[model samples]
Target: MRRMRVAAAMSVAALALAGCGSSTESTPGAGGASSSAKALKIGMAYDVGGRGDQSFNDAAAAGLDKAKKDLGVETKEATAVNGEPESAREERLQQLIDAGYKDVVAVGFAYAPSVKKVAAANPDAKISLIDSTDATGPNIVNLTFAEQQGSFLVGAAAALKSKTANIGFIGGVNTDLIKKFEAGYTAGAKAVKPAIKIQVKYLTQPPDFSGFGDPAKGKTAAEGMYQQGADVIYAAAGGSGGGLFTAATAAKKMAIGVDSDQALTAPPAARPYVITSMLKKVDVATFDFIKSLTEGKFVAGTKIYDLKANGVGYSTTGGQMDDIKAKLDAYKQQIIDGKIVVPAKP
Candidate 1:
């Protein structure tokens, strides 16, 4: 499984290079009209936890909401269950296309196979893929991110704030993509304090991706880390992050969130313990894709959103990050200028 994920990640990188990092290459539009001329009917296929995950999926939801309000696009949505198969994803997408929703947006790397298969079957449809590069075609736009860069910032935050000089990392799954989070976080923490003790855990292995949705697993993993002396924990586990926040509250420790500002979006009780979040900016990517399609400028290729593009960063909500904001920004600049190269694997 590890080897497969590594190969997949490498494939994405190779494809990005081959595509020349086409950030805004406009292809012939699907409908060839401005948004005002005709309202676009878009279908969103959300990853596990759907719109209320308060982390990854919620960020995607925000983009969909903004597009609906600002561009006047009509939209429908479908959510994936905890243990659904690839065939299910393929069917969900096909259903949307068959229903006349010509522009479809899929919310995770898990949807790549389905996107590719469905895009091939429906040549007239435009499909936007988020967080993956495995799928390719003239009608598909891949929206990916430099997730490790953002994770590095929050990892630094964890190390800086750790009272015990020990931190923890919880990944939703043991995939190469999530490994980027672990790699950046570990690198950042070690850079700040070489002797700091860092513990890592993943909720599930591949082929059982319920880790992204299982709060129980998150809580269990976090509690164990806290028991082992970790004072701060970073979780890249989609909905499972809520469990980490819960564990933080119970243990009187701190937890870092991913993909969205969990300090603001998490439940009120969990807010106080959420020091920061690695903002992945799925919202920006999603909104941009819809806007491009609506404006008759749909593009097919990988668009990598990184720290330089303001597509990924650390959130300072709740004012807990106020003291270290300048330092984080400086590190951000160094990364943007190529002084620091964050690893995509651990």
Candidate 2:
């Protein structure tokens, strides 16, 4: 299993290099924009928690920061406010556009409509909308991730470590996007133990994305799962993931984090409970998108970050997952080898 994993991981690395080889030859920015601009001006419109959420938003911020450092790019940032009307989203994105930001990246799927509208209004602007699969426009680049592929790895790890043969999943919001996490996790857990008990819960539903930020609600939901016999839980709830970490610590259980490496970023008290994180490689996507734009290789279509491309994987930090690396790697190889097709829906 370990050998299979190493070989599979190597394949992804090689493919990643080949995959990015021609990104420079992609379609020019809208209006056949030139890369001779005075400076690389980039803009970021973050989700509710913005850069400090220690989850999804933070991952995006990492990429933007890398761009600023490596490319010496000038940047503008916009924050999301809960329950705000769609007009507010449009205004936030438009503010950056009007501010002369040549490349603007919207950080969440909720910005789909606004991105579509804004990108259309500014046909010459370079727009990258994350987590969006559709929304056609001249310069609109949809950035999506193979979240299910990564989620399955973490689920298998949880199953391997669970003496109770029970695990849990907590999603921030009930949407097609979050469902993908649940589906992949359940499949992976079952694959490992065949009869592993999986508990699932959602923090909130659409039109109410507050679940991503409500740590209290997250703690309560995770506590319920833990009480019901789940020894480990996977959290895909953005900032709310912090609450799951807290619950894991208090219950003396384990929690799998998402997006960034939570073992390094979670609060000191909760960090110990974080066995591993499903790395979504948002920073890579963000930096690559900006890099493409600056180099005039900006493509105006969907770019998928999937396991085969090393865009998603499970973190092996802190050595907590070392004991099960072979098992986890086997599953990873299977997914990359097309032996396992992780579902994007529940």
Candidate 3:
């Protein structure tokens, strides 16, 4: 089973790379806009995992690719040093602005202060920060996702798929944002099976902020949960989730992934174990915002994309998920039809 899982993981990785390569080279922005016609220069800064973790960074890159192809925009990207200071992030943003990239998209909450400050300094530049709420300046747009709604669906799935009724949640940080995921997940699991057991763990407490990149901690947390008799686990720990997946695979248990389609992100041994993922449409949001810039319809201030807007939901593909797909679809439609209200905060 382990060897088969490894083979499957390798296949998924190859497919993902192929998908990325093909999509990235096609037209460069939305609608195949002419790059020669006053090319719009854009830059993006990634969060902890950088580009290849196959999660948030990759989703943002997908948006940039769409912008490049459809809108004919020139783009560049910068990586954050893992476990580094926020000052380094700020310096990179400044460098991008200084290099004449007028429109910038910073990919994580860690970039909030830097994005706000940089946007304030360069009034002419348009900046959008995803997964963060600190961009309140005139030139910056804050993009926040309704991750709770999607997490609710995945949580429900975890409850349904669990043979042991005991589940676990591992988070990157213990912030209100990450708590939103935990709260929704807990609520969703309870909604499905009121007696379900959930063991919650956080990779970091207050002030550390290393939770997102700490896979070692995530692995330890997952192993602890497994020892505690959790048969299914849900990870909202960014790069840390990779460790959780590894633990699940090793324990021969199941796990639920987050952010992007984690069924594709995790190693093969964890793929079949990953029943489904909370699909937060970061790529779509990024692409749409950049398209708005091209069409002169760029809206400033905070833009919230929730389940109702198709900006977030649960994944249905990647094998062994067909049985739960119908239920997920029904729940999704109910949410859209105003029959269900998924909470945004814990």
Candidate 3 lDDT, tens digit per residue, 250-283?
9999888888888876787678888888888999
Supply the TM-score for candidate 2. Answer: 0.87
Encode model 1's per-residue lDDT on 46-90: one tens digit a residue: 987788877788889999999999988988899988778789999
lDDT of 1 at 18: 72
In angstroms, give how far residue 154 of model 3 lies from its true place: 0.5
Which ranges in model 3 have alpha carbons more than 4 Å from their true place?
1-37, 82-88
lDDT for every model?
0.91, 0.89, 0.85
Per-model TM values vs. the true structure: 0.86, 0.87, 0.83
The predicted structure with the larger lDDT, 2 or 3, is: 2
Residue range with the least summed lDDT across 10 consecutive positions in model 1: 24-33
Clashes of each: 0, 0, 13
> What is candidate 2's lDDT per residue for 131-227, written digit by digit as tens?
9966768798888999999998898888988999989999999988888888889888888889889999999987788898888989999999999
